[model samples]
Target: MRTIHAPRLLLLLGTSLVVRFGQTLRSEDRERGDVPGWVMITLMSATLVAFILVMAQGALESMFNAAMEKVNP
Candidate 1:
């Protein structure tokens, strides 16, 4: 009997599940909203932060330092 390693077994199982899920989604082909919205929210938030950092970097840094000082001291 051939033995499969643990990592290899997990990879195989993950791939099988992904393929099965893809097949199920294809068969349904309607109301596809199986998305983790956090992804988009995170991207949007990062973009907003970048804009804020560019616009008010000094103000933001000062605010952060003040907050940290209050927390620490």
Candidate 2:
């Protein structure tokens, strides 16, 4: 009579499931069409511009205040 180690059996089952899931995801990704190059470029450019504007917002506010003070004073 042979006895199976329950922990080892569970580990093997879990590993096989993860492998299968990864393979399925890879296959699906292969089947999907890639995003257009221009779309990605535009999205990246917009993101960079937004980040720059957000980072410089404080400086912009101070510049605007200085200009306003010069005009008023």
* Model 2 C-alpha lDDT per residue in residues 1-73, reported as the tens digit of each score: 8776654554555455556545555664654454443444555455556656666889999999999999995
Which residue pairs of candidate 2 clash? none
TM-score of each: 0.39, 0.43
Alpha-carbon local distance difference test for all models: 0.61, 0.60
For model 1, residues 1-73, the per-residue Cα lDDT tens digits are: 9998654554565555556655656765556565534444454455555555566878889999999999995
Native-vs-model 1 lDDT?
0.61
Top candidate by lDDT? 1
Which residue ranges in model 1 land beyond 4 Å of their true spot? 28-73
For model 1, give the 10-residue run with minimal summed lDDT. 35-44
For residue 3, model 2's alpha carbon misses the true position, in angstroms, by: 49
